[model samples]
Target: MLQSRRRLRSRIFVSFALFGLALTSLFAAATIYMRARLEDQLINNTLQREVENFVQFKQAHPEPDAPWKLSTFDAQIYSARKFANVPFAWQRYGTGVYDIRDFDENGKLRPYKLAVYKDDRYWAFLRLDVSTQRLSERQLITALGFAVLIFAGLSMLIGRWLSSRVMSPVSDLARRLRSLRRTGQFEPLAPNFADDEVGELAAALDDYAQRLTELVQRDREFNADVSHELRTPLAVIATTTELLLNAPDLSDKMRDRLKRMERASRQSTELIEALLLLSRAERSGPIDGETTDIARVCADVIDANRPHLGGRPVEVSLRVESPLAVNAPSSVVAVALNNLIGNAIKYTPQGEVVVRVQDGRVLVEDTGPGIKAEDAEKLFQRGVRGEGAVGKGAGLGLAIVRRLCELYGWGVGLRPREGGGAVATLDFQPRR
Candidate 1:
């Protein structure tokens, strides 16, 4: 039996969600990297310009005895001796731009950009406070992290919605297919789906439905024709055998042979009728609703098969519990019970074949050669004969029994007996 393991919608949703998350994460990382590079370049250029301005001012003033006081918009200048008041980290920096953390006059940690210039006469150091820039960068990173999270969540929701939309038509098609099995009615599917893969699938299903409907129609017609054609000849044979048995001067051997012929003809007619009923039921649902007595049918089947027993010492017995009744045609019940009992009798050469009805189930047990564990189930299928089968049969008796049980919503099973032979049970309770 095939089992549905997963849904297409879930797979599609997860794929889209992962793809969106990866793209969003990559974009966020790239943005953060570019921002850091640009921030560093801006800080370096600002510090270099400040250093150049200080050099130009020194050359312009040329005051050897002037008080060393210089001010810029963004940076503070200090000589090597005065720069000692700055952080030790800043003083240790060479003649290059560097970012460092320092304590201000208020003893608060702050970020600063330091530019150092050394010459033969004096060493100059320029310090620019970048606490605000660092604070802004931290805020940007925090905001980007939250944005990425929010976007990822939105992508999941969007992916779920899109997957549902994409798979809706396929789901609808599946539901229609299931409905077809129950109702045997076909409706066009292409009109309900869009012009995509789903539409193509619907078109294919419609074509298959049309072809299957035609095939079934032809099969039913063929079965009906064959039933009609065969029943005429079987009726003549049954009538001729009945007439021959009625002759008063017939010998014992001739009478017994005629009786066997009559029994065979009757069985053939009953089988054809039952098979025709089954075929009709397949096309137009279960049409036989008449209730039948289980014990009566089993007794009739035993009497009908007595001729086939011939010289075999196999004894057949029927055990009925409380006169069980089932809602099915007498022919259908007879066909199923007859096959079970007939197989039991045919297989058991000398031992007893018992038919018992109890607890809404009919069990046929025999003392024949036991069935193989592996072949127990396979014997119920068409064209499959049990390994212990003794007589020449087309291997369709149990298959017909199974079909009747299925058509009437009953349950049938065959299992190996404890010591020998097999037990076939037919439960009247409808299979759910």
Candidate 2:
């Protein structure tokens, strides 16, 4: 639900950054590998040829003290004819180039490429010091590392700039969408964007918004008509019942029936008004200024729903722990409380239905078979009911309660109560 946790723009930018890092890192690694390979090849070929040339010269001169000058290379000659002249380590070698790291005559460890040339009479050895080559390799690595850093940083900056440009149209669409929703009107959005995915999405949204606006208008008008059409008859019924109750010889039974009829009429009128208000989804100015005594309304709701217990020995009671009031229509408050208290009474067969009114909330606790806490919220969805719910209920009472609470800026929730029961809470205070 918190969509801002990872945004599409962020993903795009990260992708660009990683691509740059990977490309540069791979190139630097390849450069280091190739440089090492070529340097090794050049040194091996040069040393092999020079050592073979030294053997040919030794065969021709055949002198122990001869001027043997060469480039940055060292040479040593051994007579294979005499087994004692060659060192035990060098005697094992054939005519080839080999890598060796060993102590020199001065007892200092050095790494070199060794070229050996041998025949029936001479064993020639040529070597090159690679310490300077190793230093060059180190300097190359450092330079490549710095190059990677500079390019990677530049890529990240480019990624940020590209992300902003790419997301500008989407951000504009969101801003315009919020504005249209606030004004309760929508216009074509496709015309404002290019012919791409964004344009396609805009076109789809425009169609949906137009349909939604029409549907809302029809619903509000229908609710208004229903309230208007139903009020007149409900009013007539109340008036007729009142006039009849005052007749000369009305029996106790007849008066009781008439009183019930009058109460039902009043209840119906209040329900219509509340439903109409909810359909409008607005404050209507009246409810926002009217301070309704919610404690009194809860008491009335408890009384009205008390008869739901039927012949059961259940006790239905309202406890006013403190006076409560809300800036909302009395009808809306009555409808919400009626559903809550009525459900509590209907569910609790034998124990108790308690409506507790506090400073800013109402709690309807009932001693019935409790539901799972996880299932409590699902009960408020339309056409959803408690498991194994018996009798004639469309399962919309709690749904209506939730809708009215939302419309009035209130909060309603249900949870399992301790000691085997369910608790329904209706909060009238505004959310922080």
Candidate number of the best TM-score: 1
Model 2 lDDT tens row, 155-244: 777777767766766888898899987986677887887665566788899898789878978987888788779998999999999999
TM-score of 2: 0.65
Model 1 segments more than 4 A misplaced: 1-98, 117-123, 153-203, 233-266, 277-290, 430-432
Count clashing residue pairs in model 1: 0
TM-score to true structure, per model: 0.69, 0.65
lDDT per residue (tens digit) for residues 1-432 in model 1: 111233454546666776678767776786777578667766776677668867777788788775443323234456655666654655566688888777775899887787877655456667777775776678668767876787678777767776775566677889888987898767888777666566678888889878988998999889978988999999999899889888999999998888778767877787887888777775223256656888988888898888778889988888887579887667678788888888888888888999998878999999999788788889989899887666577899899888888777789988889888889998998447
* Predictions in order: lDDT: 0.77, 0.79
Judged by whole-model lDDT over C-alpha atoms, candidate 2 comes out at: 0.79
Worst 10 residues of 1 by lDDT: 1-10
Task: Give the CA lDDT, 0 to 100, for residue 311 in model 1.
Answer: 87
**For model 1, what is the alpha-carbon lDDT of residue 335?**
80
